[model samples]
Target: MRTAVELSWRLLRGGGRRSMVGSLLTLAAVAVSTGLLLFAVGANHAFLQRAHADAWRHPGDSVANPTAIEALSTDYVQGEPVTIIDLAALNGDAPVPPGMSRFPEPGEVWTSPALAHLMKDLPADQLAKRFPSPSGTLGRDALVHPGELVAVIGRTAGDPATTARRDVVEHLGATGGPSRIDRFETDASWSADVYLLLAGLASVLMVVPLLVFGGAAARLTVARRDSRLAALRLVGATPGQVVAITTAEAVLTAAAGALAGLVLYAASVPLLTHITIAGGGWFAGDLWPGPPLLAGVLAAVPLLVGASAVIGLRRVVVSPLGVARRETPPGMRAVRILALAAVVIAFGVAGGGLIDMGRAGMIVLMVFLVLAFLAINFAGPWVVALIGRLTAATARRPARLLAGRRLVDDPRSAWRTVAGVALTGFVAGFLALLNAGPSSGGPPDELRVAVPYERSAAVAGQAEKRLAGIDANVSVKRTETRDDPLDADGPVTTTGVVTVTAPGGTAAVDRARTALTGLVPGKVVTTGADEDVTGDRLLADLRTGALTVLVVSFLIAITSAGITSASAVLDRRQAYAMLRLAGTPLSVLDRARRQETLIPLVVMGGGSLLTGLFFGLPFAQGFGFSGLIGLAAFVVLGFGGILGAGALSRPLLRSVTADPAPRPD
Candidate 1:
């Protein structure tokens, strides 16, 4: 074991340019992997901490304000939706909301940063009309509007207790559902844990692409290492000893890489502290992983790396004859299609039940996503081989023919170079669905209506009675909106919105609301036209998701492309050098590399989209043809990205072409 360790160390320290380049690649992989893993951990931790802080900010079981609460939700704040929390308790009884330093006194209302931006120069009274008055319009102090920030207001102007109580009882408590004490005395309906889980999910998604890059960097030179080990075996080393030597080398390299990664992670943390997440950026202390966790991660990565190395070498037993000549891998088989088919079928079955999906359903869907990802990976090489055969059969040029044969020769390695973009494209299909949310023919027959939380139940009855007097034929289709906080552990605001859909057009909505205007109290936004509101929302989500994918996948692509180009050239230098001697042009070789990346990119990227659609379309029946547009856009972006990655090998190809042919011997 000592001898094996020493030999491994010596090889690591001095194996010529290939080893030097491979070491750098391996180090880069470890650093990136460590950085990504740590980032995920930090991000997850930060999200939870922020949530917990929010929960603790107003840690009461229920609200205890004396004045009646009239809560409503609206999209009036900075184009992002916000809950307009109205609390009109007498004097000292009005409690502060979370994340705020203090509660606003009688006439003053605290506004969220978003809301404050909109409050510019409006007179106090005009501002009050847009937002709620603290107690009611009677005993008013100077009109003080905090502007466009998220707001907390009294129900009426700064009225005394007697006036405030009468107003609260008159407006929110007309139906007498629950006493004021009963409202704030009970625990909030939802749990904060849900948000944490969501944060974890985001982290998991982010980490997947990072690992893909790291793994590609770490493993690109495996073939050369195997050849070296084969030579060792030719001398007399047993397979077990060879394994020990290789494992030690991997551990040593991985450990150094892990250490370098830790340093990179530490350096990047300050940068993370500046990027806002969940309404606020994290502090350095907030994102720091504890020593034990850091140590554990550092310890675990090497062992995993070592194990993977051993697994990779399973079929690589060294022999004198094998050392002299490499073995040919098996051909792509038709059986590979079953792997993709199984995932698609499983996704379809799961998605069939994913409508209005509950927590369990979401979990099942996420599991299916993971399964689909693995299946795509497993099927990738086979699909590449298929494309290769097709390409080789139809190719009319030497470059195209060479590229096609290369993919057929080593489809798995080729697949690795472009898989990140493929996976990212898979995610784009779902984004397409988001961008094309539930399409109902004309301007989505939905009206978003806000009402006071206290007499919320009464709004329906009142609307019915009033609408009956005007037109009984006008039906209201309402969707119940539960006031789940924006995220788990987010502040609890009782404000909610109910969607009232009138399929009978804008005129029907006017007719229906004309009667309810006298009875149902609160704000109603017209949604039958100017439907970009939904587009704005879905587009925002899409942009955010796309940005994350683009950054991570691009990183993976560049890293993998660089490493793969070097590794490929190293593997075929003798042949390439001879071809150079025989007068093959550099441009032809360059085109070959371009085709190698472009062909699989088109194939794998399309396959990813198809797989994503196979599952997504089942859930996207509510989405219209616009979803197709999103899918098209995603495929185009992926194709552009892969081409960009292929272009990265230009310098390497130039250098390879420049080298003179070696002696034929």
Candidate 2:
């Protein structure tokens, strides 16, 4: 073992410029893959943290012996949602909320840092006057994200605002009445669930491509490594010694790369916090995956690299003479095609909803989706080999012919060059067709507020008196009930709705809205536009998430293409030298190299895109004009990125073929 480690260190340090370059390239690839994987995992953790933080606002079943009463409502200021939680202690022993140091005195309010900042910018009547002067600021544990707007106000038990009444429009998990609770802990809101689902899907999409890239990192400069190992076997080195040397070299390099990746992820956290989701930007701590998960990722990446390196050693280990003679391995079997077909068939059946499994059905669909994604890996090489054979049979140019023979000689290597782009193409297709339908528009200038059913006439009279001085046509009416557009079957019972027609537009609307603030305790004054805010925000969030996923995928794809293309040049240096000596032009070889990546990229990338569209059909509404535009843009960008990556390696190819003289390993 000691001898093998010493030999490995000596070889790595003394292997000249080519070997050092290969090692550096491998390190860079592993670093990129590791950093991306951490980011994907961290995103999932961030969403979960937000969910837990937001859960306190949604109280669960009432306690038998309650100590406090809590009522939740929402207010809108400058088009942003502000969650207001009204609380009254029934006893001195009532439990304190998550971020408060103690139970609040009546009329006291605590605001999130973001809300306090907004209050400083806006006039008192516009926002600050809606609540009593903020007595304290809520801690991070009480807020979903750093930018979330939340306020906790203390009220007397008999305060009108504490009276039980349904909201005009239901926000997430709003029950429309005060709940008796002994504690703040509860399940997360439905919006959190939606965010979580999207996060999980994004993680899966990113993780698969990153894993593929990481494994491919082990195969960089495969030809050189294989020859060097074969020479070791020819010199009578024991198999165990050979394995030890390979493991030491691969593991050390991978471990160093993994550490570098850890640093990269850590450095990116500040930038990641700027990405808004669910109407707020993240807290720095939200993006940190704790020690256990971080350690696991660090260990897992190096082990994966080591395992891949060992797996690629079969030829040298079993038939050293054949490797020394430079024989091409047997072609990959058709079973790869069969395996892919089986997975696709299974996915189709599962997605068809043959059974009424409910939540189980969703789980099954997720499983099939993952299998289908991985199936692309199994199918890619087979498709490349088939493309090579067809190209070889029909190619008329030297560039095309050389490209075909190289693809046939090593389909796996060829597949690696395009795999990232192909995967990203699938992501683009899946996201492109999903459109959140248009917002349900309403009378933009109208303001509606819900009051207690028993006091509808009284509240309406009070509202008229309060808004009498406003320079607008304000009408107050008694409304028996208002139906929740989100929940068609559940109608919220309210006493009255204050309707304001502001001829002066937004300024007048603001005046009317201010006049009606605190008219009914515990009731929110909302505009007709407020009803559409949630839906519009959801759509906007989805678009943002889709863009984020596509950007990350493209980065990975482009990085993979560039690295693999350059590595392929290193692997085939000797071959390029021989071809140059045979009088083949560098231009021809460069064209051949580009064709090798381009041909498979178009064929497999298109296939993957179609498959993604097929999978997304269940969720897609008709494609809007924007959707089509986005789809076209993705295609252009995907192809352009791969072409650019392949082009980056042209200089390396020129250098390799610049010298045609042969050299020993």
Candidate 3:
């Protein structure tokens, strides 16, 4: 073992420029994979933390001998959601909330830092007047994210704001009315759950591609490594010694790369904090994956690299003579294609609602989607080989002929070059078709407030009186239901909606809402535009997350293409040298390399994109103009990115083919 380790170190350090370049490429690949994996894991953790931070607003359970009463309402200021928590203590023993040092006194208000800033910027009547001057700021533990706007107002036990008569149930078990509670913690809201699901989905999308890229790192310069290892076997080195040497080399390199990846993740934290999700940007600590997770990833990456390296050694280990003679391995089997087809069909059935899987149906569908995604990987090399055979059969140009033969020679290597973009194309297609279109809302200037059905006339009179100074001609009418998309319970049927329309513009709407703030007790005074705010925000968030996923995917795709293309040049250096000596032009060689990547890219990328669209069809209501535009844009960008990555390796190809001297291995 000691001798094997020493031999491995000597081989790694003493290998010439080509070997050094190969090692660097592998290190870079592992580093990128490790950093991205950490980011994906961190993002999931951040969403959960955000959910936990805001869970207190949900009010866990109602106690018979409660110490406090809590009422939750939402307010809109400049088109942003501001969660308002109205609280009153029934006894001195009432527990303080997450961010507060002690229970607030009556008339005291606590605001998040974001809300404090917004209050200072807006007019007193427009926003600040809605609450008394903030007496304290809510801490991070009490806020979902750094930019979230939340206000906790302390009220007297009998205050109308906390004791309003709510006829509708907001969530499943709790009425919209204030609830008695002995504690502040509870399960996350439905919105939090939605965010968590999206975050998890995004992680799955990213981590898989990163894993593929990481595995490809082990195969970089495989031709050179195999020849070297084969020579060791022929020199009477046992298979165990050969495995020890390979493991030692791969583990050391992967460990260094993993550490470098941690550094990269740390450096990216400041930039990641700027991305807004769930109505606010992240806190620095929110993006931290913690010490245990970080350690696990560090260990996992090197082990994965080591395992991949060993797995690729079968040919050299089984028959060193065959490797030395440069025999081509058997072609990939059709079973790879079968596995992919099976997964796709299963996904379609599960997602299309063909089977009644109950509440776990969505979970089952997501699992199939992931399987289909991984299956694309399994099928890619076979598709490449098939494309190669056709190209070799029909190619008219030397470049095309060379490209075909290369693909047939090693389909796995060809597949790795375009796998990242192929997966990215799938993500782009899935997200594009899932976009929600613009929602039609009520008249922009109207302010709608839900009031008790019995007191409709009295509330209308009070509303008119409150807005008398703002607009005397303000029309007020009572309706049967509240049309608020943000309301989790859907349209409130039991309550009466008091529609208030003023002659003036948005200013009048804001003033009307302010005037009717507590006129209907616990109910929120929302505008006609507010009817679509929830849907609009959800759509906007979806687009943002989709854009984020596309960007990250493209980065990985481009990086994988560029790195693997360069490594491929290193792997085939001797072949290129011999071809050049035989009078083949460098231009032909470069063109062949580009065609090798482009052919499979066109075939596999299109397949994955179509599969993504197929999976998304069940959820898509219709193809929106924006979705079409996004699809077209990504298609153009994906092809353009692959071309650019291919172009980057042109110089490497030229350099490798610069010398045509025959050298002994």
**Which candidate tops lDDT?**
3
RMSD of 3: 3.3
CA-lDDT, candidates in order: 0.58, 0.82, 0.83
Instruction: Write one digit per residue (lDDT tens) for candidate 2, span 96-121.
Output: 88888998889999999999998998
List residue ranges in candidate 3 displaced over 4 A.
Answer: 165-177, 354-359, 452-454, 480-496
Model 3 lDDT per residue over 305-380, tens place: 9999999999999999999888999888899999998987776656778236533665666676678778998899
Compared with the true structure, the alpha-carbon lDDT of candidate 3 equals 0.83
Which is the winner by TM-score between candidate 1 and candidate 3?
A: 3
Badly placed stretches (over 4 Å) of model 1 are 1-5, 56-201, 259-297, 318-320, 332-334, 393-395, 436-539, 581-584, 621-637, 656-665
Ranking by TM-score: 3, 2, 1
Among residues 3 or more apart in sequence or in different chains, the pairs in candidate 2 whose N, CA or C atoms overlap within 3 Å are 161-521, 161-522
Worst 10 residues of 1 by lDDT: 138-147
TM-score of each: 0.67, 0.94, 0.94
